[model samples]
Target chain A: MREKLIEFRNVSFRYGEEEPWVLKDVSFDIYKNEWVAIIGHNGSGKSTIAKLMNGLLFPQEGEIYINGQVVNQDTIWDIRKEVGMVFQNPDNQFVGTTVQDDVAFGMENRGIPRDEMIRRIDESLTAVGMQDYRLTEPHRLSGGQKQRVAIASVLAISPQVLILDEATAMLDPKGRLEIMSTVSNVQDRNELSLITITHDLREVVQAERVIVMNEGVIWDEAKPREIFAKKDRLREIGLDVPFIATLADELNKSGLRISNEPLNHEELLEDLWTLHSKM
Target chain B: MDITFKNVDYIYQENSPFAHKAIENLSFHIPSGSFVAVIGHTGSGKSTLIQHLNGLIRPSNGEVHIGDFRLTNDDKPKNMKELRSRVGVVFQYPEHQLFEETVAKDIAFGPENFGVYKRDIEKRIKEIIPAVGLSEELLERSPFELSGGQMRRVAIAGVLAIKPEILVLDEPTAGLDPRGQKEIMEMFYDLHQKENLTTVLVTHSMEDAVKYADHVIILNKGTKYMEGKPEEVLTQQEALNKVQLDVPEMIEFLYAFEKRFGLPIPFKRQSVKQLADEIQHAMKEAGSHE
Candidate 1:
């Protein structure tokens, strides 16, 4: 049986008493060593969930549990050690001048030994493929590279959960792909649980499960293929299905008997080829 | 106003240790009232090229013509205010520039400075509020109190309030969600048509470039790599691959499907239904031959 790494029970939150609820009775569980993608339109209470996870914001109602331990003011600092978040703006999170110094910043705050900090700085940078630019300043690096450095800093803390809150939103297509692949490799190599809050469907294709949010609620939860199956509804809720999924849906609608929903281009082509050979 | 670049070269911080050539021998023309997209990887001189549109940066060498105004190395446009009023630029993350207490005042700030009468400024705000997809109720709220997406629209509305002939947008939808991205791009498209505004979009999204732009310019290493209609320029895979640029998703899918099935499928920016019908027709023809 898989262990639950994080759990949200009947969680509801609002900015203030007068403000409307940002999250309404939301509940979800992230399994250990699993990759979960949380997607929704902006102002759908996605980023708020990220903050609540790390105790940056406390739940106005309900309970959030990390490894079966309830999170509150007393346990916030302890919970933070287990959850390391890389936010949207890389420049905003970076506190150090050079890449190495930034990666070491988190560890230095916790008063890790000098030799240990140096070791983790090297290891985490290599994991994100940013080892060569350890001495380079943050401004000199590209947006994608700076984000990878941010990821490295998060990794240096050795957190159990890594929350990337739209971390790839500001990057170009190539840069977005770079961060995705790097995170995938790091997740596999390190066995870290990843919660990627994003609107990008391509990133969702790689995740084990997807949680759809809308109107400050958990709209639906399913595997990537299942999520893509609801193409019209997804678009209605302001999210886009992957290009291949849309293509498959189109082909199916055109009287083609596609045996199953194809998640990628190769799968779609395979389905077509099977039909073509039979024809 | 139509814009032209004549062998323009831009060097940042000339004669300093950090000096670098941001653009080199770049030359392109943007016709009046036409929608053009500038695409390239980061630091490929895309930003440097767009900065010349509205006098943000003068060329280090060569000349740029924005309608009647001419900009060169030694001489700058004398009427900088008039030049700015003619060309409105929405820089990346435009919300970062919003500082007014209320949305209406923020939108009015630009036109008010350009000598728009107080009464006209109010009229312009009322007109542009809905154009950027914001309700009239938002005009009274503080810009800081609005959500990030709403703040972005307010900022864009501020620029549109200027009523410029040409609008230059630098990744205006950079950090917005999918729906926000679509709404903003669609709003710009409508403005480009209904208002007959000359729109120049600097973006990283190939999908947006393929969908909206009449002309696409690809920049590489401080130079013009390719310039043509979106259909012609984006279909050539090898050329885009050489510069590490990505083709739009639809084109990439068509390419991969053709390679796998050995079927030649023409690429065009078509609706999903149209593409599905074409593929079905092709498949039926192949089946009958078999």
Candidate 2:
């Protein structure tokens, strides 16, 4: 059986008594080294799940477990060390003047030894392809580069699970691609559970599994292919399938044989060629 | 307003030790009432280029003509405020600029500052409310109380209230969801048509440029890399990739299809369904020929 890194059991939460519940009875499990993407429209309680996993906010009704330990006041600090989070705005997350200083900031707060901090800083920056930019100031770097630095800082903590909370929303298309590839590389090198909270369907297509959130609830949880198959339903819920999925559906409607869930351009084209040969 | 840039150059901190050129020797003409998309990377001087639209920054070593107003390094239009009243810029994260107590007040602030009549400001608010997908009830609510999408709509409504003839959008759909992005872009397109506004959109999404813009300008290292119709300019895949840009997914797919099936389906900005129809016809014709 796959080891579960994080689990939410019948979680429900609200900010205040008068306020409506932001998340309602949501439950899901993230296994070791799994890349799970949580997608929803704005204010859909998707981001709340990220906050709950690391004990930033406790669920009023249910429990969140991290490596078999329940998250509460006493265990919150320890749970936080196990889960690292990268927020949306790169400008707001910077606490250091230079790239290397920022990566060392997290480790310094944890009171790591100076020699060990230096070693981890170099290792993490190299992991994110930012080793050459160690002395570069945050302002000198591009949005994509700054985000890579942010990822390196998170990696320095050596957390078991990493949560990116709408991390690419403020970046351009190029920056978004850079962060995605960097995260993929880091995951390959480490046994890290990735929870990406985003609205971009392009990024969602790369995930191993997807959890769809709608109106403070778990609308659906499935693989990327299964989730994208219901294109019309996704649209109704204010989410979108990727362009390949939409185009594949169009080709199928025009009496052409194509997979309903082509993940990329090459796959859909290959299916079309197979259909053409028989004709 | 029609815009023309003649050998434009903008140097930040000029003559100082830290001097850097943001835009250099750029020349382009945007005809009156045309839609233009400026495509480039983050530091490719897109923001610097759009700032010249409203006289926010004067060209360091060139000429800029927006309608009757002219700007140069030494000379700017005496009536700078009037030029600003004619150009409305909806910046990235425009909601952060919202400061008024209520949505109605925020929408009225721009027009009121421009000396528009109080009665006319109220009329424009009423007309712009629905144009931005905001309802009448939202006019009384505080802008901070609204959701992210609603706050953005409120911010856009404020820009539209100015009744500017030239509209500049700098990644206006940056943080919106997929559906919200489509709705906002469509609304802007409708307003552009109904008002005959000259629209300049600085965007990273090539899909938006292909769908909405008639003309496209690409910048690389503060220079004009390419400029022409969207179909002609965006199809140069190698040139765009050199600048860290990509063709829209539809065009990319058609290129791959041609390579794989030996079928050439030219992209004329066709919808997905239309492209599928053309592909089906091409396959049938090829089979018959065989």
Q: Which ten residues in a row have the lowest lDDT in candidate 1 chain B?
A: B259-268
What is the per-residue lDDT of model 1 for residues A1-279, given as tens digits with 9 covering 90 to 100? 999999999999999999999999999999999999999998898999999998999989999999888899999888988999998887788899899999988998899999999999999999999999989988999989999999999999999999999999888888899999999999999969999999888899889999999988999999998888999999999998888888787788899888678888788888888998888
lDDT of 2 by residue, B74-128 (tens): 9999999999999999998999999999999999999999999999999999899
Residue B66's lDDT in candidate 2: 98
Per-candidate Cα lDDT values, in order, are: 0.92, 0.93
DockQ of each: 0.78, 0.86
Q: How would you encode candidate 1's per-residue C-alpha lDDT over B23-107 as one tens digit per residue?
A: 9998888899899999999999999988998898899999999999999989998998899998999999999999999999999
- lDDT computed for candidate 1: 0.92
- Scoring only the A-chain of each prediction against the true A-chain gives TM-scores of 0.98, 0.98
Clash count for each candidate, listed in order shown: 0, 0
RMSD of each: 1.1, 0.9
